[model samples]
Target: MNRTLLIIAMFCSASTFAQSPVINNAEIDGSGAQYQGNLGVNQAAGDLQQQANARAIAVGHGASATTQIRQRLRTVVDPRIDARSSIQGDSFSHGNGVLGVNQSAGASNQQANAVRISIGTQPQSIDDSVLRQQNVTLIINSDPTDSEPGYRQIATSDQAFTGSRGVIQLNQSAGVGNRTANTLSVRVTD
Candidate 1:
């Protein structure tokens, strides 16, 4: 029978080239979508899969926050003051990682604020080749008197690494005061 079907087609092509590459199905679906920013996947004899979905607000690398309020009445002078502040950070990794964040604020009658965050990871398996990384940071500061002196700050970072080993980085910052002493920043170093 043709030499037993050519030895079962050479043992099914050597078991499909020694079988070992799987991630069956990957998906990212958004109906009525507003925003979908970043995603990556790799497969060409080496395997890597990654997915990040639905992000309204994302920050990385050096982070911070601060908010404020103050009021005064004449003559006998009555001062009623209200103050507010905030800060946040995030980092993610599979192998070889670093993340960071910091924030600050100050006022005359006195109001101050700060925030910071960091994350890291290393050593992964399942074919022994995959190093993924992500970092975020933000900072804000504010000061107000005679409705003139004020400041705000923001910072951030982001990264993604894959099979032949992939890597990514992102950062952002914004500061406002003194009739809009404005600043907004961004950095991406592959």
Candidate 2:
């Protein structure tokens, strides 16, 4: 039988060249988002004050039928005040990271998209490859009145993102002649 059909057409053309690539009339899309925030306040101290004072004395004596004979003494003292407060050292911290990877395959009528977001302060230095999207935010504060108190605060943040897109199309009929090949790769890791 023609040598067993030529070994079954060489095992179906070697299994289609060890197949591992397929995309037919396709569309792909992706997205990513991130945010971070932190705040802190602390105070500790001690204080107090007080005061007092007072004194008086008088005496007189005269004749004329034992008319005048008198003596007087007076004294007074009182005053003290105190106020205290302590706030266990205050502190706060925040951190964030984002890696958005959008890989789009090839085919006819194909579309792909990706995004990452953070707003405020600073987000661990940023580098955008094709700029998918990224945003980061952070804020810290401390305040006290009445002759000044005390405070300590801190905040931190970090973020990352990556995106990739690839599209390929092959259509033939009108004249009967059209063939194509394409490949796209994207990566972001930490």
Give the per-residue lDDT of model 1 (tens digit) for 90-151.
22233232221112122111111111122213211222111122222122224354553223
Residue-by-residue lDDT tens digits, candidate 2, 78-156? 1111221111111111123221111211111111222222232322333433222121211122333333312212111
How much does candidate 2 score in TM-score?
0.16
Model 2 per-residue lDDT at 11: 89
Q: List the residue pairs that clash in candidate 2.
A: 117-135, 118-135, 118-136, 119-136, 119-137
Worst 10 residues of 2 by lDDT: 47-56
Q: Residue 32 in candidate 1 has what lDDT? A: 13
Worst ten in a row by lDDT for model 1: 175-184
Model 2 regions more than 4 Å off: 5-14, 18-20, 23-95, 98-100, 107-190
